[model samples]
Target: MRNVAICGSHVKNFISSPSFVTAIEMDGVPIFCGLIHTEDIKFDRHIPENRFKVLVRKIAFSYNYRDKNLIFTTAIKAALNRFYVVGSEFVGEVIDIGSDVTDFQIGDKVIGNNHYPNSGIEGVPGGLPSNNSSTEYQVFHQIKLIKVPPQIPDEVAATISIGGQTTYSMLRKLSLTEGSNVLVTSANSNTSLFAINALNKHKVNIYATTTSMRFEKELKEMGVKRLIQIEPNSENWVADELAEEIVKEKGSFDCIIDPFFDIHIGKLIPLLASGGRYITCGFYDQYSSLIGKEFQYRGLTTSEIFVTMMLKNIQIIGNCIGKTEDLQNAIQDYASGSLNVVIDSVFSGKQVGEFFERTYNAKDRFGKVVYRYD
Candidate 1:
């Protein structure tokens, strides 16, 4: 059988575990290099189910210590170390299969939904659908292989996999009934726009913020009741009167969809109703560690989100897309024209450095920038 090949580019080398087994040699000698031997992974169906799950655990990462320091200002730099390691999330096709492997065969195109929770940048990683670190062909578990849907384009599917799944998980936490007043921050974003598209069927009153007049106009055309464009440096906009005006006009948002973390928890804490919920899921100039710690320290309105859960009957939730079912549903919605993929721009893999440079530095672009894999 001819082994499939895959490759990707990154700014740094990926480091591998020292104890991983080796089954192949390069230039007549074994070496820990870019290539991994498929023979190293032996699938044993005879093993007990507990042992199988344990083997799965062996393939996963356990980095759960909540150090507030790991969060960085840049996404690519935060992932610099992970670029070398080949794990189950690094998708590889099955060139040959054992008789017991009933689910896979040769020539099958597949991707691994890394089944490890919070292994990627931020706390967004979850099993099987959360991370998209699959930039190359490497050894992957058959259990992790999810066939690409026939109707969906691979690039769009890849783009939606993480963001779509995260939104789906958030929706599970919410009961977005009709007539719910919702204030959606970063309404011009890829995930935020998708969230708004998802909420379109409900009788929810929509209020959104954008920095671009063009995007605000586009969102207003999509049915947002009111769209506010705030300058990034506008200090006058964050004062008490503006918040009060928002409260009076919107009748206090029953739920806020904040993909952008710009509105500090303290800043918007008063805008939520007594039993309301605030959901944040986007990457701001800072990461969750900074926001999480600052909100905990400020004793400001954020205290209600973190502490009032036990005392004030309110809820604050963080959202990220996570679930094959949700992805499947989202695909259907996209096919039927209910959900949309707002691609701001596309960059080739070689141009990804420039892409990340702009994404991290530019403060104006509203849609997602994606790389088309060759």
Candidate 2:
């Protein structure tokens, strides 16, 4: 099997091996580095009655922002003689099943169920099918996978599991009514793009925030009423003329869906109307390099944030990747033409470096960067 992995500062591919190791020297220190690669993962040919093994001959996978932290942490563990397979979203086909497995067949396409907290089945442990999806083979419980309908393409299916589940979960928490004024921060992110597409069906006045307007037309087509541009490294929402004007015209947002609370919460709290809701799924300062380099916004203090939320009755909610039904509903919406995944690019063959660069460092990336293992 062939797989792509993160190596120190480069992306590389290598064939499956019993023991694989790579390291890079920096400042005279040898640092072991690699995350997400194929391995000779062993599985019983006589599978457990409730489990199945997938011979993932082809896979389309993508990265989430959280992978940055995973990459850094996994490298540290790699030095300690620990091995980890890391990837969050992907789609694959099953080629083998347990004798008792009845719901899935050898040729069915599937995505991770990702049911959080509990796997729903009594004995099947689950959070994600595996925290690792980049590998070419995996064993999963029947409850840990969801069959994908034929209408959804591989690229879209690979990217949908995390973004779609989280988006639908956050929207459920917000529970905004029709015609409500809603703000979606980090609007170009995969989760936010999914939110925007899902929100288009809600008949709400959608306001999105981004550092660039490069995708302005596409966002508008996705039903964003206004796109507010902010300084890349600053949290000066009040100083942004377009943001201020929108706030003045709309009074205040009825709900806010933010991807990064550490960056947006202080700047956006004052914009939440009384009894409004503020929900966030994740944050950006996940890796060590970004430590102590938090965004700076003027005038908003911790005391003021508390006061604003208290006085306005704002509901601040935190969410993780959602239930199995959320992923199912998202796929159903996609099949019905009510929702779509926006893919920035797809890579294959030896474009490993370019794929990782576009996924992690592209300033103009507007959607998911996918890798198709051919």
Which candidate comes out best when scored by lDDT?
Answer: 2
Clash count, one per candidate: 11, 0
lDDT of 2 by residue, 296-333 (tens): 44546889988999999999899988888888889999
TM-score of each: 0.63, 0.86
Cα deviation of 327, candidate 1, in Å: 2.2
Residues 1-374, model 1: lDDT tens digits: 11111212232143233212222221232222122223343444455432211111111111111111121322223343222331112223445454445656666545544333443434334565312242233334455445554565544554554456656666657788888888777677666777777777566888887666676667876778888665555544444666567767867778877775555454556667778888876545444443333322222454445665546556878765455666566667766777766655555434433443333334665555544433
For model 1, the stretches where C-alpha displacement exceeds 4 angstroms are 1-134, 211-214, 230-245, 260-263, 282-312, 319-321
Candidate 1: C-alpha lDDT? 0.50
